[model samples]
Target: MSQDTQPAYRRILLKLSGEALLGEHHYGVDPAVLSQVAEEVCELSRRGVEVGIVIGGGNIFRGAGLAEGGVDRVTGDHMGMLATVINALALQDAIERAGRFCRVMSAIRINQVCEDYIRRRAVRHLEKGRVVVFAAGTGNPFFTTDSAASLRAIEINADLMIKATKVDGVYDADPFTQTDARRFDRLTYDDALERRLGVMDTTALVMCRDNELPIRVMNMFAKGDLQRLVMGESVGTLVEGSRQ
Candidate 1:
């Protein structure tokens, strides 16, 4: 589609996992993956689709993983939140280098580094066509970044939440373990919940369901997947309140 063409959705909340930033590595940010992601985001932004990203921290630290190692849950979660900030900063830098103005807003106060998150301010940034990166995961210890994404998407009144995953779409069973696992092109929120599809955390999925928000689960590294989605092409599984 041309840059002047209207995108299928006016605005979107892009949820990225910290693991995705690792690319081929086992830990930390990979420069190549970061560049590719930045380019994809820049393309979408330049084409007039407002973008807000909520990224996870598993690549650096995961509270749940730390807790299993006997670390204090709250302390580990705080560390995880900080890891997310690190990622958000890196992403903001990449976005700027990609030629789009970007803002990093944290749910927790880190006045020295990033702006404190304000819903109105975020909305205004999107209105001005600036990409917004939300960090720190809802400022709560227990909640995952997925919850933050859902909450922010609803607050921003986004057309949909795009969850960039390693898998192409939601499967009826675990794709890695089940050779016969079936992928759904679309499904209702209730069905996803009843079948225990681990597309998103329970809290996040429930929040989206209650608000009637739709979610698209797509492979982040898939070539042109984001563009196809913005252009209304079938790229991944669509989960909504009903089969729309």
Candidate 2:
């Protein structure tokens, strides 16, 4: 393949907020959004980039919000985990429909619905050119899906981790509210933490920093952004160690 068409990374872990699947709706998964995301993923797979995904459950449930409303924190988190599984299944269907082999692997077991997450098996699936979607937030309470994305990316030995968001990249201020907000092209992990950039949770940022894993934050809704990013087109805010 020519340099322009070749993918930059061999394998990647994509972290998507559940709200990304909300589209124009106030709640629930939006079919249009799911289809669009699946098409993007399948396109990457077709280009020989191994893809793994970790999607959040905020659209269906928010554990932290419920805990503040008098529900038990642990119970709420478990419920939130289940919500992720629901999204994984939905996304898996969309990916398959887009003509790619997909798997839904959960941290928590649901034998009849999906495979229990196994590090070796998940890696093997990626090597075989299949997309794996990881659901459930570390199978533990109080851990965000961001943390799970970092953990899984490390475990799978991914070349990069991509955090998909509505915004094009990290900004000095809320881009939607601040018309003049400056979007950062690059940032160090320490810079992100020190400035409280909210690129990901502190734990997730620290994990990537300590492990030397790079993260690319980009707008998922933008046409061809994901494709351009994976093809080494530099379409997002890249966060890594101070070295680069």
Candidate 3:
């Protein structure tokens, strides 16, 4: 597909924060939000883009917070991983309910439920135009869904990684707190690092830069923002440069 004739990305990795599934609530998965997401994703698939998704488990579990209260780190991480599975299941169901085919693959062994994360199987699923949802945070402790998103993006050879976020783009400071922060339409990895931006973790950014994958950070909750961003419109901050 040519840029002038088709969708901007042939394949894409979508990183959805668990908080995004909350709709108006600050926590937990909301059915309505999940349905809306399904609608959006179905629309994207109909337009001929291969979509692979990675959803965070923050709403159901946040390991870092659990560890602060004296819970065993590994236990907390496992809980976090399970939380991601729950979200993945919800997303899978929602997507299917929207009448699109999809597969839920888990990094951890949960064969009775979702397919174990196998790189080739995942690629095959996407190639068939089925949305693939990756869950369980790389089946390891101390890694984040951000890192998992990057890993999947590379493994599947996605054209871009889309971070669906609360904000439209990367700002110099917290937009909710800093009135003076400037919103960027585009940026380089070095510039983001020098400014201490929190668009993604250092590891995720470095991996993307190293792989030379273009990343777009956008407020997906906004109406049609995902479509706009995926179509290569200026809907968010496009992080440019080689992978670090």
- Model 1 agreement with the true structure over 147-168: per-residue lDDT tens digits: 9999999999999999999999
TM-score of every candidate relative to the true structure: 0.97, 0.98, 0.95
Q: Give the alpha carbon lDDT tens digit for every residue of 172-218 in model 3.
A: 88899989989998899777777779888888888998888888999
lDDT of 2: 0.96
Q: Which residue ranges in model 3 land beyond 4 Å of their true spot?
A: 1-5, 242-244
What's the C-alpha lDDT at position 115 in model 1? 97
Q: Return the candidate ranking by lDDT, descending.
A: 2, 1, 3
Regions of model 1 farther than 4 Å from truth = none
Q: Least lDDT summed over 10 consecutive residues: which range in candidate 2? A: 1-10
lDDT of 1 at 114: 98
Which scores greater on TM-score, model 2 or model 3? Answer: 2
Error of 3 at 204 (Å): 0.8
